[model samples]
Target: MRILLVLVAAAGLFGCAALPGDGPAAINITTQDVEDSAQSGDYTVVTIDPGNIDAIRSYRPMAFANQFRGVGRGGSPTLLGVGDTLTVSIWEASPDGLFSSGDSGSSQIPSVVDEHGYIFVPYAGRVRAAGLSIEGLRQSVQKKLIGKAVEPQVLISLRDKLSSTAVVVGDVAKPGVYPLPLRDTRLLDLVAQAGGAREATYETVVTLKRGNRAGTTRLEDLIDYPENNVLISPNDNILLSHRPRTFSAFGAVKANQLVPFRTKSVTMAEALATVGGLRDERADANGVFLFRYEDAELVRRLKPELAEKLAGAETVPLVYKLGLRDPKGFFMSQHFEMRDKDILYVSNHPTAELGKFLQIIAPLISNYSTVQRITD
Candidate 1:
């Protein structure tokens, strides 16, 4: 009597929004919203088939600049610059010269490269030293003292350097400015100088901002590709960001959690297994969906029509459907790679909702039946 009325009311509520649901049903998500929409929606669903798998891949495995060639050979970064302290030593055969005094035939004079890129000596009046090497300035001083000194030999030593320095910030053990002595100093050398990155090579993203033209590459790419380990330039900023790639699993999956990518990349099949696969009792095999915000250029190649609808957009919202009911779907999943921030959601089976509803009312029905018997 009471149990029957409650059962009827619960059933009526189940058909409405009152029934417990982990997420929207497969059909409602797939079509119902668009069908009853007052305006067109921002997203579109596409089936994952053999024809679209290749077009779906926009993941940048290596973002390094392909044409990036490091500094030239023979170690050419010996040029002088402003704010450098130099020790100019001049040696003469006789003790009586411009840079010689007492019984010594040599003298060491300290000079700082001025703002005008010049250094002054007693004999060599205002010679350019900023753009020239130490040897170049030494020769210029020697030439100036040719007639003044007896067999003069001039030598210049750099004391304090302030021009050829680079900054290393972000996920390094040491984040500060470092001097780059040689022009051919590679990326690996710079990273080592900073006590290496705080994170693993694969998990870290290394960015190079050089003047107006900036580029980026994975730390793994620098180690693997010898050419990608570009030379460090002065005023360059190298940032090692500890950005680990990850994807999320929700709905009918065994674990609704964020899954980290251990390696450089992981296939869709591997991602599914990592999250414990789909829930057998509740999962709808036909409704395995992947949600992503794809680059507009990739969308143009796959669905030109959709791309046309969303003109001048940088990224487009996409929902990719994969049906595991077919045996072919298993092979397709193996080749479909998972991108960072991608979402894997398996819809619940329709009968699973009925199961939940029945479980909720079972205790009420049993208690009511027991009361009816006692009253009788």
Candidate 2:
């Protein structure tokens, strides 16, 4: 009972070491006296750079697909352009005269709007067709010919409509501005016309610019739901882009690399699969480490202190170290839920560092050789 009481007191003392009363030197992992006797020239202190240490207090993923959800089916006004053909029918004129109207068999010259955005008629001379629709341009011409002709009546309709086409660039197979027909075309139909996002990665994000205003949206969101595939207006610029994915993984892996997640959520097993799994020969199966952030004091803060506090009571919470050598561990990997920017590290034998060092140095040497060849 006396020995048990002594052990309990020692455990309580160890717990007090983290409290505020533990003095300034308590931050050191080991005592100076112990370091001096160890004789291996004192252990190298690991200085944690603030930049390298990821502190997860409050973090949210960047907004995505918001613009896609808000796309509407409304059609905006469109302007007329050159190379457009129009059929004009005028009253009180013969087939050989200045104005004439006949059946569909009549081979009349389809009035071509010139580079100056104007068309020439016998009575009206040259008039601007740039900003005016077919009916609007015809009405202006009819008003101009009223004094010259006997109460002139005019009708105009588009014969060819290839002058106005919206440009769709980037990521699509065959990207170009396609001419829109009589009815308003939806976003998905335009994508189909351009051969879709052939080179797009994961959730493809696209930008649509109409006039001076621009908005972004995901292609998948529009494709997945019928609502988002709304009508695209004329003069709208569509851009398809593959945004880079950013993530980092560390610990007892063969090669640690910052690979693209290409997804919203990634499993621990999938993360391991990305780095070619743990080094089977050198890894310590029992020392796998997953480091995540904890801000408990920040969670339970007073209202007054919350305003000024950057952060409080930060900790590197670790997860279970599975013995994958055992058969049951393969199943345990399924339960692990990986958060954004979390580092999953598996511990390994000391010699594994040599492989890591060589892997890093080889790239630098190769890059130096390439520079020499280029200079020579």
Candidate 3:
């Protein structure tokens, strides 16, 4: 009997608090409340009220920015390899020191970087040359030719690179790591290397990771601002995630529900198409709604809050909603961006909230009575 009652209460908790009539109900969430909770340093659900879009747009997290750019900075130091090229020049050495000295137009041998990331010298043996920079490799050769020739002067450089690579995964055309053959590999170059993201993916949502941490960057931003189109670094990993497909449709809609669609990037018009749309036959189109959760707390945090609220409840719903179709009704679908684990709900037509409340309570009471009777 006790177990039965507990189960009943649990179900009631999830399906309760419904408003009056058939259509969705009006939802009210205050920006002040969210801010106050945030200021208190509580990592709880920071319910973003309808008017908070501007705040979200302007909000910047420096931690996230630093995480992405860090990838290009921590690669392992190594030598150049095969299929590599370099342009070498000796400062004050004689004809033999510079391959073709005095700009003679090189009548003898064709000078070019080798495929093995190495360069050949007249008497210096085959010195490894691929990975190192121009000055870096130069010092290396200078060190190697100590007693070989008369003050054997040496200078080595990377004239051409042929061993660069990067990995692409998640939502791209061909999800795998690829090799790049140039020192100057751009963001778009990698995208091309991977064959681009899948058709179901949002091209704008892409992330890059160096090691453990990752950062998000927009495709448009990289195109419009070349600086964001970062240069590729060796051993760097790029992951592309697909946006979630769930949305909330509320207000004058016939049935308010958390609906799941096949793809992400859903428009207000498309969301409406699901669940039979605004019960124009019975709903108020102007009052259609979608309640989204912005900055919802993780599931772990919700459990403690529910325990405190219910005194000893086993579980609780730690979710908050913001209605979109209220003031700037039409803007609901356009400006709203859906994220993972988001909640979408259509509001009840005025009278539905009460009916929902009664329906929820009735189930609980009946469940309790049935349990008691069975026990007796």
Candidate 4:
């Protein structure tokens, strides 16, 4: 009886509250930590609801598809520019004319557009070739050589394009420099010309660098949304890297590690099921938490009260809680979209904390009971 009294007193030491278990409990998130307030990281808790599921889905990570929209892919006419190699053919009606050579009445001349955007011919000197199409430049040369040669007929053909080329690198089957097409060439078309991505579209990330600005998004995003594919431009550097989306699973789950997203997206319900679900013996069903960092602009729209509080902050840390004890929570989880690098944690049950305490002191209680038996 004395030993039993001592055990009861020891259990009473943890009165009003259970012992600290694996990670913070759902109740601890909002309350202040009286002992060391600084230790508790600043974060906001958001409850998942049907009214805001669409808004949550709208704001995803690494989606710079907006940058691609309205940029590049203009159907501009391809003209002869500086560093362009051209083949000029000149024909003369008389054999004694300047362009006539032996029995042949025509002579072929290889020329290059100079830095000043002008090309020099045998009879026509310093003709403006830049910004002029093959047919347009041909007419200009013929007009210039009208009096110099005997009925000179000038023909201009683009031998090589030295400018307006883009570089394709990383994860692509053919990584090299390619000239931009005359017609409208979008991102997908440029990628196709490079022999496509070596990795799966869903598993690859496309990074486009244009001048000083650059944007990154999943290759799958460009494939799924045509508008986001945008247009390809000269001097644009494209890179395709393998970046499989994944999230970390921690706390009272069956397996504690990083879990990969198999499809284009994985919801909270799917994420939980991926790791064999929460542990029935140890997990607190009411304390399922998902930790993420969202843009401040999005947070202001979702939670209007936070507009003034988060000044100049780009991203705000948000902890989303879902209580499975409520029958509607299961459905809410289905609507809750998970982003890359999200953390899915299940808090330990209060009863489970007690069980752990009991396990630790079980040998001590057994030793005391054996002593009592020996004394008796």
Q: Count the backbone clashes (under 3 Å) in each candidate.
A: 0, 2, 44, 0
Model 2, runs deviating above 4 Å: 1-76, 79-109, 112-117, 122-124, 141-155, 159-165, 177-189, 200-218, 221-237, 241-248, 252-255, 258-269, 272-376
Cand. 1 Cα-lDDT:
0.78
* Model 4, runs deviating above 4 Å: 11-20, 30-41, 58-79, 85-116, 120-126, 131-136, 148-161, 225-227, 308-313, 374-376
lDDT of each: 0.78, 0.57, 0.53, 0.80
lDDT of 1 by residue, 1-376 (tens): 6668976686758644576666766786678343222126466677889888766664443235532444233122678998788898889887766667776778989999999999998866888898898788888888988888789998888886666777899999999988777446777888899999898888888888777656676788787677678777777778999988899998898999999998877988899899999999889988898889776666666766555566766566777888899988988898888877899888999878767777777887789889989999
Which numbered prediction scores highest in TM-score against the true structure? Answer: 4
TM-score of each: 0.71, 0.44, 0.51, 0.79
In order of lDDT, best first, we have: 4, 1, 2, 3
lDDT score for candidate 2 against the true structure: 0.57
| Candidate 2, position 318, lDDT | 27
Q: Which prediction has the highest lDDT against the true structure?
A: 4
TM-score of 4: 0.79
Residue-by-residue lDDT tens digits, candidate 2, 125-169: 887887787778978988888877666677777765566667899
User: For candidate 2, which ten residues in a row score worst on lDDT?
Assistant: 21-30
- Winner of 1 and 2 under TM-score: 1
Model 3 per-residue lDDT tens digits across residues 1-376: 6886687667656655422343334343222353344335332343334555455444332333445564565332345666555555543344554343566522132234566555666555676766566567778766766665445555454443445556888777888756655346766678877887665443446687666766676554455456666766766688776654456555556556777656545655566666676653334333443333322223223333432334432222333434344655446455545544454454444444445555667867887788879999
What are the clashing pairs of model 1?
A: none
